[model samples]
Target: MTDSNVSFLGRISLAVGTFFSILGDGEFAARVQRLRSGAPVTQAPVAAPAPTPAPQPAAPALKQASPDAALQLLGLLQRDARFIDFVEEDVAGYSDADIGAAARVVHGGCRTVLREHFTIRPVREEAEGSRVTLPEGFDATAVRLTGNVVGKAPFTGSLSHRGWRVDDVRLPKLAASHDASVIAAAEVEL
Candidate 1:
């Protein structure tokens, strides 16, 4: 199973959020680069590889992630919050108040599903904006370095985000006849 302890939905969320973090935060991007190259967390940065005129796409080599959990989670969200509808809607024509109201509904339902299905906790113990120092060899996966990162570790910085980790997942088991692809079945009034 390509599945680690994290659920498919959790990984998806992480990937999307990380994409934005990498783009806006140079320090976060640097840390990701270092980790990708198998460098130690405290090590000085490495020079970027020379770009080739033509680059080829690399095929994924790891075990495949099953879509069952992701579909199930989406079904839950759709059932609870009409999530698919909300996202699919063309909101450019809507007023701010209308959007805010819909967002509240989505947020509440999503929050409920997450809390019920996943035991999530902060990666750091220190309060955000507090000065905290990471000694040599901090867990790179858990705590990503961001903003003005330099030299070795024993690095001190203010916490911008505490970060979240899924401690446990409690998604219900799939039935023998379950169709994972159908995130939500169409309903009609009789």
Candidate 2:
């Protein structure tokens, strides 16, 4: 072979020898080093790394969702009035039972809508707080609920906690302001 070809073969051999040395089995290069009067070298058989148990991936941290998160969710719902449209308020009026059932649907659907919207799913629920106590890390100064849907008398008020559950919705008050009344007058077509 030419000098360049011979040199290339030598480099390939050196690279292969180094790879085996790193894998902790080959010692041919050690003999070559001895012949060249380099420093004596020995490897401690790598000890099979003492079977380090692969570090176990740190067991994946346990994530818990806070109750104040519910408020953020509520904020989103308010921002998107379309979600409220799901509750069907176009009818003339609804009975108390109808209002209660509608409330349950909207309230229960909040969490599911959120999960469908974002990542970072919660593995388990954190301890929920009462309406009086906002969740930790919650900044009231920055939070705002701007969307106000004027619906039938069944969608009003701030979210409130009933026992362990949070109920922030309320029925809309009747159209009985001092200026306006629900009484039949002049047969106005709504």
By lDDT, the best candidate is 1
**Taking the tens digit of each residue's C-alpha lDDT, what string does model 2 give over 107-135?**
66665555455544222243333223234
Question: Which residue runs of candidate 1 sit more than 4 Å off their true CA positions?
Answer: 1-63
Q: Which residue segments of model 2 deviate by more than 4 Å?
A: 1-82, 86-92, 118-190
> For every model in order, what is the number of clashing pairs?
0, 10
Q: Rate the local accuracy (lDDT) of all candidates.
A: 0.82, 0.43
Clashing pairs in 1: none
For residues 1-190, could you state the per-residue lDDT of candidate 1 as single tens digits? 4566776557669899999899666667888998898987686566675333222235558898888888999988888888988987868799999999999999999999899899999999889999998888777767767654556768788888999999999998989898978988998999
